[model samples]
Target: MTELLGIPPQLLFGQLLLGLINGSFYAVLSLGLAVIFGMLNVINFAHGALYMTGAFVAWLLLSYLGIPYWAALVLAPLVVGLLGILLERTMLSRLYKLDHLYGLLLTFGLALIIEGLFRNAYGVSGQPYPIPSWLQGGFNLGFMFLPVYRGWVVLASIVICFGTWFLIERTRLGSYLRAAVENPQLVRAFGINVPLMMTLTYGGAVALAGFAGVLAAPIYQVNPLMGQQMIIVVFAIVVIGGLGSIMGSIVTGLGVGVIEGLAKTFYPEGSATVVFVLMAIVLLLRPHGLFGRTRT
Candidate 1:
């Protein structure tokens, strides 16, 4: 058996693949959180719930409405994004002028409510989501077998991540988003609808989470609790990357995933805690994350 630093390549490469897959989900989900935090100054603790909703919606569409995976990928996010818009308009918007903690608390409560409702309806067991026929096999990659769906995941995530970064970092709409985030009154003077923009930003962020959920549905069992653990790890990734830094979040997410994968290969016992350890080190070293800038 071929080995990498005395560890078998099969084991190392396989773990790396798993890590990259997890990182993709983290990148997508954290991107949403970063966008919302940048624009609305809300931490959006309900993000995981929104993610769960996306997966559940996909599952529902497939099981009940006979929607195919391709269609669910698009429709589920729209449904969940509309739900996010409704939540923002009804509750979150009212709290915008209050303490930021209030927004966090409100969303945290919303998360509980959403999770509870799903648990009540579905119980805790995971529901299987079928892999589309097109991506149902693995390819021999010399070092290890690579699942086609997993490769698709990594490629798709890279495209989406860069696309989002480009929109936020390069475009005029992105300029409006940043301007409104920093100074809504000033932006409004230019006839921009800051509130509407905020609403759409929140919806867009939520939709990103939904998009990730759809991507993940095939690989993991679709369950109410799926997003709970993931969101926590993503929070750590966000902190390590620095809040509101899009590229930082993406890099940190993938880097941590790879580190975690390597740890699992060398010391399985410590794999679970490696991310938190890295997070602490980043906090102590930088105080504001690896790429976070001080907000004025």
Candidate 2:
């Protein structure tokens, strides 16, 4: 077997696959964070808790309520998104006129509260979530055994990320969203319901996080800590991708996943820090991020 740079193809490809899978989760989660941050100017630290709620909701539906995975995929996000709307209406909306840091602090407190509640209910152990029967097997590609579920996750996330981007970048509704973000008073003057739009945007952002949670349940042990574990890395991804660039969040997310995988293969000790290192480099090179554009 030919080796490249002292690494075997089999191992290399396997790590790359792992990286891609990690990237899928990162892309979806970070995109959600970007959406909420860009439009609402709120740093939603509760995002990870929402994600955990998503997984737990799906698990609860299946184990206790007899709901299927497919149904959960649709319903879990809706439930979570509705909660997000409530949070916005009752809590987050009040912070809009305050410093953006206030929103971040409020969300952080919410995260701690949610995670603590889950921990009290479920304890620290992870619960296993069965993979849907239809996607239980793997394909024998010439070079790799590609798990059907994993492959589907990658494809699905890509479709969703781009679809969201298209909706925001191309659609008329997106134009209004952008306008509202820039000047809510002006948008409302045109008869657009800016408050309602803000509610929907927050819901949409939380929905994305919930969707990611559903996808992750099958792959990871559905635990209260799962979202917390991933969210830190995701925050790093958001920072590196540029706080306000949707495309930047998606691209940098996947790219960093790949790099992290390679780092694990070559220098396992460095894998954890590689993302921060990359962020440092990106910050040094492009302070506003790779794709961020000035609004004016």
Count residue pairs with overlapping backbones in model 2.
Answer: 0
As a TM-score, model 2 comes out at 0.97
Local accuracy of candidate 2 as per-residue lDDT tens digits, 160-257: 99999999989999999999998888999999999899999999999999999999999998989988999999988998888968998999889989
Clashes per candidate (backbone, < 3 Å): 0, 0
State which candidate has the highest lDDT: 2
Task: State the lDDT at 263 in candidate 2.
Answer: 91
Stretches of model 1 off by over 4 angstroms after superposition = 1-5
lDDT (Cα, 0-100) at 100 in candidate 1 = 82
- What CA root-mean-square deviation does each model show from the true structure? 1.3, 1.2
Candidate 2: clashing pairs of residues: none
lDDT of 1 by residue, 1-296 (tens): 43536888888899999988988888889888888887888989999989988889999999999998899989998998999999999999998889889998999999999999999999999998899899899999898999999999889888888899999999999999998888888999999999999999899899989988889888888888988878888889888999888988889888888898888988899999998999999999998899998887
Lowest-sum lDDT 10-residue window in model 2:
1-10
